[model samples]
Target: MSGLSAALLELRRTLDQEMFPLKVGDTASDRHALKELAGQLDDYLLPRLAALDAPLLAVVGGSTGAGKSTLVNSLVGAEVTEAGVLRPTTLAPTLVVHPADAGWFSGTRVLPGLPRSTGGGRAEAGTLRLVTAETVPSGLALLDAPDIDSVVKANRDLAAQLLAAADLWLFCTTAARYADDVPWGFLRRARDRSTALAVILQRVPAEASGPVGRDLRRLLEENGLGPVPLFEIPELRLPENGALLPETAAGPVRRWLEELSADARTRAAVVHRTLAGSIDSLDARVRGLADSVERQRLGARELADLAESAYTAGLTAFDDGMRDGSLLRSEVLARWQDFVGTGDLMRGLESRVGRLRDRVVAAFTGRPLAERELTAAMANGVEALIGAVADGAAERTVDAWLATPAGRALLEDEDVAQAGRLGRASPRLQAGAERAVREWQGFVLDLVRREGASRRGAARAASFGVNGLGLLLMVGVFASTGGLSGLEIGIAGGTGVVGQKLLEAVFGDQAVRRLTGEARSDLAERVRVLLAQDRGRFTVLLSPTLEADPGRLRAVAGTIRAHRGELSGGGAK
Candidate 1:
């Protein structure tokens, strides 16, 4: 493929993958615009650019009951498309082309997304009916599109798609509904895209034609469509057979279309003009989509930051609980005191290091009941702290998300919120917290084993065993005197000092400090990891939106803009 085609193809791929899943600013409109741009690329720009020599497709589109099907039938002098009292007279769009031009419409060159049906009784949904008519000029084809204002959403969407695919739009509206907002909206779109257009004012009384036509023309001019052709078909009675309109009524439009078709240059001009306009319109439209992508990216970032902040605070809270002598209270304190006779240990902990060492050795060498209880108590305390921190983080993150529209939408999504998954901690978090604590305790035991590798250290460690030393290390971590105050100094602080001094006597003071610091750091690191897992629930929801790169979209738009001249010259052949 040529560079321009390759670039356009890349643009199409980008748009196809682009997402505005978040409920940010005007997201609904952004999604609609995205669909419209992608549809035009598939149904019109890419196909028409590939085959510019093909017949000019003039799609007849307008409000419901606007007589678009009747106008098309009258112009072709046959009922190739259905017309009736039904609200949506045309269910499936009908494309009328001369027998010589049947090959162009029969294939998948244009409107390829829609299925093609030749033997059309009534075309199925999303099917295009092809009808060959000798009355249609070879170089020009007319498509009778569904009502633009149909009550059926699919019909309205299909109408817009068909109109976007047209090289020329034959917008039909009755004189009475000429000023309606719906048709005017389409006319404005035609004006913006610079699509070649002609307005058919059907069902006009001769006397009212002048005033209505002038008013419609003025509205067109105000909407930047002043140069568009206007055809007025005066209201006239049809035959009993509900046949085509009188020749005089449809003659002007019929003659104009035929003359345009006979002149190859005119047909080419119409195709080229619409093609140029469509390509030129892409830069702004794509850039607008890029802006929406950026908004989604920013919104995702904001939610992620909120989650991160909540988890970070949770980590800080865990750290604070560890140091503030909080874990040293209640059951943990009672177990530690029971493991080492606290009454004597605390009273003389500061003065008698040697005696304390002997007492620690004797206590650890006995039956392992006290050691097991003390270790279990420490594990439970740590697990509880972690569980509380995770719960707080989950709650904070949920509350923060609920404050934002986009975040709330994601949290409320059925996939995210089913069974209330997003509003609280994961069901497995309690088990995860327990597992993490056990893992950290194992790490402390490993640290004790490694530290005891030296002959002298091993001799001292054997007196207490690795399990006893590991339990002492856990006590040192929780009962740190750094954040204690008041009565805590006498209770949790004194308890920690006993554990610290006992460790010092076993392994010199410096080693004891080093071991305590390592144990604390390891436990903190484990809690950090646990909190991060809890935070993942929120960030994962934002991942898809965050992955949409605005820069890629802008780059594609820039590439298209750089090739504007080439694109205007009818793209790469």
Candidate 2:
């Protein structure tokens, strides 16, 4: 009994070191493998400890024809069990339990996968029997488990499970089945778990005894099987084709069983040995499954990086669209040559209203050229400039993006369709230009017409002085710069410099020189206002975002500075 107690304590110690913190149930595939191993240990071991008030059990487990029933009958000193039965000797496990305890038998029927129980003598059909025996040792029980490698599938599974719950296992195998793969596979499983195991080499054939013993030892050593206590029972004499093992050598088998199950010390040792080893085995299986679970956790980081990559792609598409709108500058530029050219443009403009002050002084100057002629010329000139600029910029913009790898990659390599912003067909800019042209043109004309109507209010007023301040008085009519004809105004700012040319075309430069240079300064001032009013709206929209990252935004700022240079250049840069 002391040996049994010590063995059981040792088993508990082993379990604490290896599988104390077992977690079980409610996990998916890879995790479920670990969970199941832990569950088996808990289910088997926890119940045993809780039933400590019940007698200790030694579960005899082994493969078919290993003489397990023969060994059991020998230990009990009676022909109490059938052997070599075609129906299988132990269809259900028979328990030799303490007689007075009806507690273990009361609700045993509800237990899962276990067979039915009837009385204290025999377990019912489809169940293991619990029998009471007085000489069965105080606080001790023994189970004759089904053959682990039985032909019946359920029996095989039941045997393996019973092995897990066992406090002590009598591992019986004949010399013939000793090295069999299926039995050894279970042996290995038990070995890793440190299950308390005592091997029985039963019924050795006389001819192959010596060689087989050596081979078995060698195989056991290679597999890390412990120096488990071994009990060898020689083949006993029997009638040919007999139904039972002919009895002999019952003494040795009984002594070992008593050592394992009878006295308190030996029983405790058996208990300790079995449980400690089983915990170690359980830990290993669970740990292996845990490693697989960890590999899956690492995949989440990859998913996050993929999201950031998508954002970068979107920003790139937006940048390309901005560049596309820049091409409309080419539309504006197309008018550049024509607006800057030598023509009757200045002469014609001066002839219409160049002498407005003098004409007003002469009574009919208040009525200038009709709105239709002025409107027609301005529209034709702006269209020509826009068409020419749009054509030149279309191809160049694509090439510019292709000039460097970054820009080329932005234009040609990406999923541009996903970005959906257009570089070529940007209506914002065309709209901005077309819109600016219509807005400011109408504004200027309305100013001229209103002033014309005001003067007509006084039909007899002597002179219409072309006041340089007239441009300022015109601003009250419109809401935003989008209403301005900024494109034409931008092209004509250069033409504004040729005041001498304007005077010559209208009144002959010779005649103008005869008057004061002070008069020419007055003319220049009006032209300056015309130039400013034309460009005021477009300039306001071109500023940069203050919140953007400095290094990235620097390029946008650089583009703006270069376009500003466009205003400063004599058209070369």
Candidate 3:
């Protein structure tokens, strides 16, 4: 193969592999058009240009019952192609080549996607049948394609595929159907590609030919197709052989085709004109596809950003819930009050100090049942706050996703919207909070033991007992610095004062403050990890879209567009 042919093959492979996975319906470009263009490149343009000197192929295309097959047979002076009244008589395309040029059409020079078949057997489906007729001129081949507007979808697609392979289009339409939209749609396409073309107005009534021809000519000229030669095949009678009338009826059409076939330069010019125009259109078409790819990337990225924002809101809301003193009301407040009465703890701060210390020590050491009850209430309160924040985040994320095109696609699956619902508290959350609280309790006891080892307060620490002192510290941590303000602030602070006085008795005021700060920081760190785990649920929903990077796709398209001329066999201008 030549350098140009190899380049074209590589380009075809590249087009076959290119994909844009994101589909945003409202803002999405027509992907079907991109697919059709790629099909044409692989089935027609690339293969044809690879062997540029092959026989000029003219595809006979028209609306249903337009007599394209009859014309093909008449031009070749034989009944080589089938013609009938069935809605789509030409289910499979038939290619007629001069006996001398049979090798050219029989080989895979163009339309390589369709399997080649020899006679008419098994040609009812998508196959091309090759036929040879001695009378047809050697330099040209004619393919009778299915009706452009056939009711059968496969026929319509096959018609378009055959037309794309043509170096010239010999369009046939009747006087009655000539002005129809469907046939003109194809003529407009031929004009856009600068394909060499001629039209035959078959079954024309002699009386209406003059006026109808003039009107049709006017329409053609208006549409930039005035230069195309028009031939008239008057309504003629078919003989017993089912063959067309004598040579006189088709003489002019035949002579024109023969003249084209006899001139090698004219045939080459026709092939080159269509080939170059098709190749040059590649960059713009691919650029359109590339732009669609960018829209997909943008849409997917926006969805990921929305998920991140939703989770960030959850984290912020959870932080506010912890410090607002809202969780310390009702059951939690009742338990704390029962364990240490509110009146005496707040009033006897400086006065009656010995009585307050004894009462605080008795609350810690003597009432194991009250300590367990307060701990249970605090854990349940923290768990409930965490669950509410997670639910709010899930709802927010779903609402935002439903508003976007890409998000709508995701929401089509009911499970995706529900994926973020943290439902009941996970076992992991309950176990994690429990473990952190236990560790902090242990840390408080160690603090007392270390500090009491060298002080006069050592005897006081022994009476308070590590278990009681540790539970007291746990209550003080809940009445965190930020968690104390207003009336509730005074109440929670009063509780803190009881715990603080007890600890300060054993370890001095400065040591007690430092121990509280360290214990609070450790608990916060554990809670931070728990919140991060919850955020992962939303991220999981967006994983597939985020992983498919459109940048690589756009880069590939850009590379192909920039080098398309070199890739498409030098056909690019």
Candidate 4:
């Protein structure tokens, strides 16, 4: 493929992948614009550029009961398509081409997304009916599109798609409804895209034709559509068959189409005009879509940041609880005091360190009742702290997300909304916290065993057993008075002193300090992992938006803009 084709293809791929799932910044309109742009790429721009020599498709579209089908029939001089009193006369789009030009419309050359049908019966929804007519000009095909203002949403959507695919639009509107907003909307879009177009003012009395035509022409000029060809089909009775309008009524349009089609230069000029305009219009439309994608990306990042902040706060709270000696309370305090004989032994411990070492070593050899209780109490305290922090982070994230429209939409998603899962900690968080605490305890025990492996007190460590030493280390971590102030220091200070002295009895004062720092760091890392797992619940909801790369979209648009000459040259070929 050429560079321009490759760039356009990349643009299509980017648009296809962009979800705009987050309900951020006019998302509904952005999504609609995205769909329209993609549809035009598939149904018109790409295909037309690829086969510029193919017959021009002039889609006849307008408001409901505007006589679009009748115009197509009259122009072709045959009832190749159905026309009736039904609100939406055309259930499916019908394409009429000369027998020689049938090959162009028979396959997937244009409007490739819609299914093709050749059967005589009414075409089903989303199916295009192909009819061969000798009356149609050789280089032109007339497509009778469904009503642009049909009550059926599918019909209206199909109408817009068909019109976008046309090299020329023969927009038909009755004189009475010429000023309606719906038809003007399509006309304005045609003007913006520079699509070759003609307007037919149907059902106009001869006397009223001058005034109505002038008014419609003025409105067209006001909307930047002054250059469009305007045709007035004066009110006239239908033939006995009622299948087509009188020849005089459609003669001017018929003659114009034949003249345009018979002259290859005129036909190619129209094709090139619409093709060039469509390609040129892509720059702005694609850029707008890129902006929407960027919004989705940024909105998702904001939500992820909220989740990160909440969990970071959770980790900080966990650290505070660990350092302030908050975990060494009630049962844990009683057990520690009992295990170390705190009241008297904790006194004057700075000067009595050598004498108390023997008592600490002997106390660990037996694994007393107080030691087991203290171990259990310490594990329970760590687990509780983890669970509380995890829950707080989850609640905080949900509360923050609810304040934003896009975030609230994600939280409302069925997957995230089951029993308010996103609003609180995961049900399995308690178990996960418990598992993390157990793993940290094991890690501390390993650290103690490794630290004691090459020390003079190795025998004392073995006698105390790795488990007993590990218990004292855990106490040292929770009993740290580094973050305490006022009463907290006094309450947790004694506990810290007792733990320090006990560990020093087996592994000198320096080893005790190193061991405590290592164990505390290990526990904090484990808690971080646990909190991260909980945070995943919110971030996962944003995965679709986060995964879309906005830079790629902008790059594609830039590529197209830089290589416009290449695309124009290719289309001209």
**Between the candidate structures 2 and 3, which one is better when assessed by TM-score?**
3
- How do these models rank on TM-score, best leading? 1, 4, 3, 2
lDDT of the candidates, in the order given:
0.84, 0.47, 0.72, 0.83
Best by lDDT: 1
Off by over 4 Å in 2: 1-39, 51-54, 78-82, 85-90, 100-116, 119-126, 237-247, 295-573
TM-score, candidate number 4:
0.91
Tell me the spans in candidate 3 whose CA falls farther than 4 Å from its real position: 1-29, 77-81, 97-109, 115-118, 129-141, 239-246, 258-264, 325-388, 413-573
Tens-place lDDT per residue, model 2, 414-522, is: 4433112322323333544455456545454444344444543322211222221122111111112222345444323322323333333433444435322332233
Candidate 3 has an lDDT of 0.72
lDDT of 3 by residue, 437-506 (tens): 5665567667666767767887777777666667666666666446555556665665666677877777
The residue ranges of model 4 lying beyond 4 angstroms of the native Cα positions read 239-242, 330-361, 368-377, 414-419, 480-495, 567-573
RMSD of 1: 2.8
lDDT of 4 at 285: 86
- Model 1, backbone clash pairs (residues 3+ apart or across chains), number: 0
